[model samples]
Target chain A: MSEDKREMFDEQDDGKVKESRRDFLKKIGVAAAATAAVPAATAKAVSIAETLQSHFELMSDEQKQKAIARLEKRYSEQFGKQTTVANTPAPDGVLFGYALNISKCIGCRRCVEACVRENNQSRDPKIQWIRVLRMNRGNLTFDPKHLNEGKPSSDPLGNYGIQSGGHADKAVGISGEAEHYYNPEQVPEENAFYFPVQCQQCEDPACTRACPVRATYRDPNGIVVIDYNWCIGCRMCQLACPYWARRFNWSEPVLPNEDMNPKTHYLGNRPRMVGVMEKCTFCLQRVRDGRYPACVEACPVGARKFGNLLDPESEVRKVLATKQVFRFKEDFNTEPKFFYYMD
Target chain B: MAEEQMVSVGRRKGQDEVIADKRVFLKRAAAALGVVAAAGLTGTAVIQSARKVGGTNARARCAEEDVRQQQIMVGKQLLLMTEGEKQQMLDRILSSHSRKVS
Candidate 1:
């Protein structure tokens, strides 16, 4: 062959060799994937369908039904009981609001216990959505004797009535020294009052805004909900939450089969997996069903109140209109639906 | 010319055999794929039916129990209240808040 002909033949040979090598590698990759999938398919621990499921919000009506059906089946098998994962949407012309009578609260943690049981929260690791702070009464009051104490003697500002005693300059309502783990012989401890804190279900929720995946969001009824499956476990929502409302599952949730609440909502109290974040959804499962939350019913003194804010006669609206109601961290401009009132 | 003809015939025979082998492999692969697809469909149908039966029964039981629980809670609340409180409580319970809009 001529010089040009020989070069062309050599190039053609190289091209064929490269194509064969590429095809060989592609076949090996396919075989390896199939082999790996066989074990996953047979084990039945995590279904392939579940891993490939789309985001809850992006799914169509038919897709949602199928997803719910899949979840219901999986939960039933795993918990050894028939579990209903309700996909109840928010009711129209209704905005859910909560009001708690702090004065009536006797420091009993029955609400906390009821919440854990009703929500199917992890028992062993003990993830509590509600934290009851026992604040000192002294911190809430200003001693008249100290009215003259903080005054600067012979100052140019001329007695601005700056006080020091009895947490004069400190944040008065909720003190930083409030005890969360107080286990007294009996509740309603003298000189102390209880303040139960949970998800405020804010109008402008910082946690939802901080979520990178849009996993957490505020529903139409003003309740903030998290799609646990879509959560990347980045803990951005946890850090962004001003009320410290969110809880993260660090390890595999240790819930006893008997203790698991079978009545669950898809976004609410359904059993969660490890690494996802969960918090008080205001008992959306029960509330959407026209029933009160477990915490609301469990309160012995009837301190906690739940009702539609849009309705003028609802208990929450009544509390707002009649009582001295305040939101925790109101300065944050979060516009929380939860109100704390003094009866 | 005779030897060249013999070699050409041998090469054609080899090519024919190779084509036949490829056809056999393709037939086997297609049969395996069909079997897998059928099994998957049947298995899925069986699992879905089982889930439906169990879910329906459990849902009925839960609904009945839930209604009973709500009545009990309402009754208890009424019993603990005075006459005026009972009137107010009843009014509130019968309000839009207790009604399921969805």
Candidate 2:
């Protein structure tokens, strides 16, 4: 063993140890230099830092040009292609509107899953783009069942018999006696309806008001938009929203590569970064580009309707005119483009 | 006036040298770290972080056959659910929504 070790050590020697050391150091230097040849991170970091410092609109002409260039460069590195942020033109004489049929909505949340996969939504439990509220019929006063039915209710038998009031003394006041009055048999009732909620895309948006930087705004087509590069991640818009439609990405999204929709829309379902607030842009990317929203496609029941409200020929306008519609939080005067019709 | 002038000149010279040195140091460090980070060493550390940010999603480690397999989560417990139940749930949602559109 010792003879073999000696032979290995001798092979590393190049007539003299000092000469070999020099050669070894040279090899390391060459490898490191080759690695460094790729422009290291000097330019990328500087551009990203510059983006952080500037108010997008306040930026000088030169800075604006730099920002556009930086965005193009960064997106290419992250997504393997140079992404162009194109100006999506609205159809002539078009105004977007959405309607949901409450009677047709089942507690099963297929739309929610479809929206998440489409929008490249974050995996955080709090980051759901759509929420399905399950409410029991005839429970006018305390609607414990009306609570956010995000994940299916805990197995009603194993965990069901326990009343909400019995869960805690504090729950008693909040849930009231109606919480304890739940019957296992009353579940899966025919009268139950699932209400899926997302950004109402209000005609007069509250979120737009909350953005101190005016990063978010309503475009001419009445769709609310957030300029991601301009967003400061202050989360003020979330607070201002009455319907709780806005979702903040505390961490990066976790989507499988196979499930990723390579087809992206800048204002709609494109992948967003951490610390940004995102909501349903009513699939503006799809609508403006003459495609349907992923949720609209995923609705097996065809409960969701999307079209232009301004065009007399549009289906959404026809639905609004013919059917009696209900808007959530109408008293708040958000003037939501979204409405619900009884099927 | 002469003393004040001398002091101001010395201070300006000292400040200029310090600023120049700091800028050089920053440039050198950025270059060095950037090279190391790009060799994927720094990025690997970020990838190790389970917390994902941006719109990027994680890749499924399981094979296609594995994806076809059904798994369920109840509270903290992991359970195997029947494929039939999953199909039923999906079918129920589709039928319910389809009925409302017309």
Per-residue CA lDDT of model 1 for A1-343, tens digit only, reads: 3644754765586568558755765565455555444534543555667768888989999988998899899989989999999998888877888989887999789999999999999874667888887765533322233333443222122221222322455422222345676899998888677778889888778999999999999777878999988899998997788777788776557799999899899989999986789999999999998999999999999999999977889998787666655566655767677877665
List TM-scores for all candidates, in order. Answer: 0.64, 0.56
For model 2, residues A1-343, the per-residue Cα lDDT tens digits are 6644654565455246547545755565566665554343522333546457565546777766666556555555666654554345566656677888766775466788888877767554335667765544422212244333322234321222212222333323132112211244543446454556778888768899999988888766678888776788898997788766777665555555556555665556666765677888877777888877878899888888998765657777676666646566555667677876654
Model 2 Cα shift for residue A292 (angstroms): 2.0
Q: In model 2, which regions exceed 4 Å deviation? A: A1-73, A80-85, A124-126, A140-191, B1-102
The interface RMSD values of the models, given in order, are: 16.4, 15.4
Q: Model 2 residue B13 lDDT?
A: 72
Chain A TM-scores, all candidates?
A: 0.80, 0.68
